[model samples]
Every structure is written in structure tokens, then in C-alpha cells.
Target: MRMSLDLQHLGREEEALQVAEAALTDPWVRHGDRLALQRRVLRLGKPPRRWRRPPWAASAQAEPREVVVSATMIKGAAGFKSCFVVPPARNGSGGGGGGGGGATGVPRTACVEELALLHYGSPAGGGWRGVHSEGGVWTTLWALLCWDVLFMDVPEVFRSPFQTAPLDLDTDAFLPARREAVDARLQLIASGGAPDLIRAVWSRRVGTWCRGVNWERLTLDDLLQIAGCVGGLGLSVVCRLLCEDAGGWRGGMPDLLLWRPERGDAMVSEVKGPRDRLSDQQRAWLAALSAAGVRAEVLRVVEAPPPPPLPPPPRPCAECRPAEDGGTQQGTVTTSARSCTAGGKARRRRGAHVCGRRAMAVPIVCEGTEGVTGGCTTDGTGEGAVVAAASVAVEAHSGMEDDRVVINDDDDDGSGGGGEEDQQQLQ
Candidate 1:
């Protein structure tokens, strides 16, 4: 199972799928391992062993809760990788791991979080300092605020001093055993004494090992800042939720913790890229946070449509003062309709010039076959005549190096004048 998860983390989806699928069938795989393997297989786009739910359980269908979903469009810049935004592999390698190691072995610096940090932490985005820990920060705050309640010598819950968390921490028994102490801590947190409790704990046990406290990423000041923004009621609500089912509730906490000290505002945002959807756990967390009066939401990052192509650079009008050479410089004739005066009459046309008495001719070099040489002339001063002459020159020169169209003021139709001088000027 670890091997499969590691492979998935390394972006090797096929091998991860194979390992997870194989692990599901292993007789040695326990119930917990089986569940994990099944989830992995499903994430890899494979159908796992289908075990039917009990009849009673099957009949119970609950309405889905509404979560606040705010959508924002962001340009899909190059380095932004997200399972939702980026196309997944055929085998489905979508996986994510938070700051504190959990079931999903996704890296802490996953592209989704990086993008969130990039956007939300920038000055243009309210300049909120963001922590990318999915639930590690919340867990740490809970642990710090309830340090004494968790470590209270309950029978069977704390069998060894070496254990980071209580024996029944992941089980339902831990809460029941420590309900009294848990309630006391909750009351204290609700009464706005969370910061004091956290400071006391940090002062006493700064370097001590604890279950969910990430000393490396979080500091004393960081915890205080969080406590300040996530006031008594908000922290109390979140702590109670974690206390009820720390194992399950901690898994789907929002991906970002954004707070502005100056404004004293904080919010948790779960970023969803193009095709991402809220998981059942995430929905529950969002609903719970909203109910508790904490700002929690699903930030849907949409891919902004490509910017409209830039208009071609402005070119000199056909009627613009001609160059001193009296010959049109080598440039492609654009298909733009413009109004120009030709001999005291205004004419609007496409790729047609009205250069008055100056009479300028634009030459086109058509490269064709290698050896044969030739030249040609065409009537009319429109660009069509120029194109027609170039085509004729290409057809005549089977393997020629250069073939061109020449125009002079005397010959308004651009006919004849195909010789060494025209060829030299064309060259």
C-alpha cells in the first residue's frame, strides 16, 4: 500500500493502480488497509471490490448540504499543475497530500496549493498570509489549546508516555473517556482564553513532542495570530468538531488558511481547479464552518479564456507620403479596407492602392523550382495583378531562384519591363 501511494506521489499512475488493485486482493490486507487500497484504486479510475451496503443503510439518503461556492478565473499559467485544471492520465493519478502526513501521500507543495499561495498571498489579492497546511494548522491550534485535556491520564487512552497521541485518539472512545476535561477546555476556548492557554502550552512545552503540532512550520507568534483572528467562538467550534472525530474531520479541512493581521480577518478556502468537485468531507467542513460564523468557501479557479489576438501593428496607409525611392518597399499587402483619394476622388477598397501621380508598385519575390529563369507582367494596379504576375513567374521558372513583378509610373498597368534591370532591382 505504501509502495502504491509512493508511486502515485511520483506521478506514476499505472504502476500505482496495479499495486493498489493487487493490494485490495491480498489476504493479509486488514480491514483498514483494504479500505485505503480501495480508495486508491477508485482514485486511479478502477472499480474496487463491490460490497453491497446493508438494506437499512441503503435506504437512508440524505440531502446534500449547500456550501458557499465562489468562482474566480485565473490564467492557466505554465507551471500551474492541478488534477482538476490539468488533464488526468488514462489511469487517473489524481492524489493530494497535506502538510502533516496523512492517507494521501501528495506533496505539501502540490501545484494547487502553490497557485493559491501565489494568488492569495500577493498584494493584489489582499496580501493575506497563507498557510498551505490542509488541516495541520487547525490541528495544531486544537492540540495547543487542549493540551492538558488530551494528555489527562485516562485509563487505556494514554497507556504510554512515549505515545504522541492517546491510544484511542482515532477511535470513538477517546472523546467519551475525556468528555469532562474536553468540555472544560471548550468552555475556556469559548470564553476567549484560547490565546492564553496556547501561550502557556508553548512556553512550557516548546520542544516537546505532540501529535498534531508542527513546530517546524508553526511558531509561537503564528499560533497567537491564528487565535486572534479565529476568535473564541470560531476556534471553539472548530476544536469541538476536531474533538468529536479528529481522525475523520481533520482530513478534509480547507487547503489554505488566509488571514490579514491589519484587518483582523481570516478565512479558509478550498481551491478547486477546472474539473474538481467538493468531496463529502469537504462539504461537511464548509457547512460546519459557515454555521460557526467562520468564513469558509470553495474557491473555484476557472481557466480564463485566451486573450483576443493582438491587432496587427498599424501600417502606413497606401496614400501616405511615398518614400523618396518612388518604389514601394518589400512588404506584404494587407487585406484591410481603407479610404484613400486617387486623382481627386475618394475610393474605399481592399488591397488596392491610389497613390495618385507618384504611381508606386510593390514587388513580390516568388521562389520556385531551382534552375529555369523567367519574368512576367500583368495589367491593372490592384494587388491581384501583382499576385497574378508572381504566379505566372513561378509557373514559368521550373527551377528558378528569383521571379518578380515590376511596376513603374509610365506603365500604370504594370505591363512589360521584364529585363536584366528589373531582375537586378528585384534581386
Candidate 2:
């Protein structure tokens, strides 16, 4: 009985009732305790009305819930689940009349066997098998589903082969055919009569293709290759960096153009390369496009292997020296010889220093001889008689005065006065 009460407190109402009933049958419990246990079991059986109605219960009833499934989920449920395939509607007048209303619709079986023949080798089937056979299957199925849903003609359905292949895949043969088919389909869509299903399928294929290519670091050559892959579709490829002169109305270039003649529609594209080492010219072109209100982008490409580092510069000659003017000075004699041998015109100027030595003559003047007083003359014919006789006399007189002043000093003043007078008389 106590155990039953404990179970009821623990919120195990079912277990508590079972334990209570079992305790009532047991002989060990007294009658009064059994009656009390029965009362507790009854209380447990009827929980508070507020507790019975939980807030979660109300929310679960009110809120609408959704289930999200991925591609993997769809693949997992592929066999178990079935889709209703609605056949093309026939004319208004039909032989068959509606009878069973609750009957299940006919199940659709995928025509996988016919897919290889329709898409494998045909020009309409983009050579996607080389890159992604499974992806191709999905893309092709999507295209066909769109055509059937929209009641589009068979020609409009398989137009334009899907050209873009995975980078890791070899698509040499498939790419060209795929491009043609894709273009044809695109043209049909542009005709303004394509159903929404066709548009949706094309959109998915295009998105997949764009995702597959590593657009960054795509080189100009690579862009040209891509253009070639889509060339048959009437696309004109141009580098946005290139200048265009439209009858003197100069303008920056547009990257890519896909024009359709039938619909008079066009698609403009802007191609970009890796950001690393983008040249000034490329940047300017991008800026120009932005200024012109054109859409543009920057993409990255795989870095190519670097070339070998250039060999270290040759060591300078040991004998080489810089000139006093801080210029490189070579051997002067060698330089001069080379200059002369080269037949350079020689320049002449006054007071120019000569390199070789030569003897030079200079004039000298001789004074009068010793003790030769006035009136001593030189014969003009003699080599030694260059000075005039009067000039020689004046020079002799000046010399006598100079000698008297020195020789007749204070030591022999009185005697020198008489001697000086005699000398004067003699002079």
C-alpha cells in the first residue's frame, strides 16, 4: 500500500493503480490501510485538469509544421514513393468517360532506357557524359519534364546542348555538341513561348555549369577557349579592357555578347581574372565599366608553376674603381686610344696643356759692370752691347751713390768726409 502511494507521487498513475490493486489483494495490508490506499489511487487516476492539458498540446494543434528533405532524402525514398504521370491532354471529344472517382492515378515510370539514345550521341545532347554522366541524366530529365509539362514541341525541348563540363572531367568531344544544343534551346526559350518548366530547367543547368567552372584566375586564353566552346550560338567575345572606337564615339569594350537573330535578344557578359597581380590596365577597365553602369566581377584562377629564379648578377671586376666625381672611371690611356681609333673629331683651344715636353726661350736683362763709371759705351755691332751708352752712365752714377753711403760709415767719419769729397771730385 505504501509502495502504491509512492508510485502515485512519482506520477506513474498506471503503475500506481496496478500496485494499489495488487496491494488490495495482498493479505499483509490491514483493511483500514487498504481503504486509504484505494482513496490515494483514485486521486492519482484523476490528475488536475490543468496538468492534463499541457501548453505543448495546444501549440502542437495550432502551429503548422513542415518537413525539409534533401537530394539524398529523395534518393533514399526513390523506390518507395511514386509520382502521378499526367499524359498529354487529348482533344475535347474523347471516347473514354470518367467512371471511378476514388481510383489512384497511374504511376509514372522513368524512361531511362530511351535517355541514352536521345542524349548520348546526338548533337542536341550536350556532351556532358564525359564530365558528369549522372548530372547529365538529371539535367536531361529536367529538360524533358519541362517540355512535357509545357506542351512544347519536341524541337524546342532538346534545343541547345549543355556545354559546360566539370573541370576534373575530360569533355573534349562532348563540349562542342552540348553548346549547339544549349543555344538552340536558349533560342526557343527566347521566343517568348517557352513554359515555366523549361525556364526552370534551363536555369538549373546554367547554375550547375557556372558552379563547375573555377572562374577565378581564368586567363585571357582560357576565356577565349570558353568563348570558342559557345561560339556557334552567335556570341561575340571581347575583352572589357580593350578600347572600342564606334565611328569616333569612343567607348570601353563589353566583355561578351550572345545575340539571337530571331528574337532580337542579347546577353551581355563580363569576364574576370584572379585578383592577385591584376594589372593597372585591368583595374582601370573594371572601373570604367562600373562608371558606365555595367555589371562586372573579379574571379580567381589556379596559380601556374613559377619560373626558375633568375641567375645572380655577375660579380664586378676587382680592378674597377669609381672616379673622383663618383662616376665609373675606366683606364684613361685605353679610353683615349679607343676614342682616337674610333675617328672622333679632335678639338683645339687656346692655353690648352700639352701632354709632351718641349724647350722654351725667355729674355734676360744685364746690369752695368763693376767699377765702370759714367760715359762707358758698348759697340752696337757686338752681342754684349745691347744697352744704350747714356742709360749705362745713369746706372753707373746710381751705383756710386749707393756704394758711398755704405762704405763711408761713422768709423771713418772725418777721414771718410775728405775721401768722399775726393771721390766726388774724381766722379
Query: How many pairs of residues in model 1 come into backbone collision?
Result: 5
Separate clash counts for every candidate: 5, 16
What value does the lDDT take at residue 321 in candidate 2? 34
lDDT of model number 2: 0.29
Candidate 2 wrong stretches, greater than 4 Å: 1-170, 189-294, 297-427
lDDT for position 426 in model 2: 17
Worst 10 residues of 1 by lDDT: 339-348
Q: What would the per-residue lDDT of candidate 2 be over residues 115-188, giving only the tens digit for each residue?
A: 22122212332222111121222123223322322222223233345533223122222223244544455454
TM-score of 1: 0.52
Best by lDDT: 1
TM-score of each: 0.52, 0.14
lDDT for each candidate structure:
0.58, 0.29
